[model samples]
Target: METGKRVPVKAALKSHCWIDANDYQSLYQQSLQDSVGFWRSQAQRIDWLREPQKIRDTRFHPDDVHIRWFYDGELNASSNCIDRHLAGNGDAVA
Candidate 1:
């Protein structure tokens, strides 16, 4: 039997990362204006792609519940994270 109770993993992870309210707002504002540029920079840092194209457009509204993602180039998140490694020595752990 467990001796002590613990918080759920999701909640624990969320609490581990803390962002300032002001910083989040600032970043969100910038993203609204130039989301493509912002994500392009992130892609470069992670070396996710050899050449990343600029984002076509992005729009965010406080009242709207949906977010729009648009780009001229194509990339699959699962492929990037897994498929790329399959050619060499990539395998999932048991």
Candidate 2:
């Protein structure tokens, strides 16, 4: 099996601007050094029913590398997007 290719949407009206290459390179290096803390901070921004036990797991050879999320638990992405938002009394746009 092969990874799916993403289409290059150069002309699309993007909601966000691209990060500066130099800035991203530095940030990427820092993130690799402390991925758990970085990811934990990001996860805090979200309202999770059950917080993650393990922030990250990078135990694999590069050739057969695989990242496993919620290795100690589970999460429902669809429910979070739909149910949680509505539960918060947030308005929905048709």
Candidate 3:
């Protein structure tokens, strides 16, 4: 059986960590309460070719259902996923 448990964050990695428990809850609430603002804030984390002027374009209805996010923005998957984070330490062991 697998035991579900949480581990304490060590000080050294805390600075590089993205969000702590409390911040995660706040982010989740922001996503629900203020979706567009949340998305706009998150979009800043990645490198964009053309920054998005509009946050979202979505319609949820039985007759017409459509959803488009960051339609105007452009980003490379490899850059966003791997290259951006490797800026300073390219030769370091993983």
Q: Which stretch of 10 consecutive residues in model 2 shows the poorest summed lDDT? A: 8-17
Candidate 1 local lDDT, 1-94, one digit each (tens): 4769764547667676666557779878877888777666556533243354644444466765554343444556787777767777555562
Compare the candidates by TM-score and give the number of the best one: 3
Best by lDDT: 3
Overall local distance difference test of candidate 1: 0.60
Using lDDT as the yardstick, the better of models 1 and 3 is 3
Global lDDT of each model? 0.60, 0.69, 0.89
Backbone N/Cα/C clashes per model = 0, 0, 0
Error of 2 at 11 (Å): 18
lDDT of 2 by residue, 14-84 (tens): 43656655777976887798887767766766666688888767668878887876566456787767766
For model 2, what is the error of residue 22's alpha carbon versus the real structure, in angstroms, after optimal superposition?
13
Model 1: how far is 93 from its true place, Å?
11
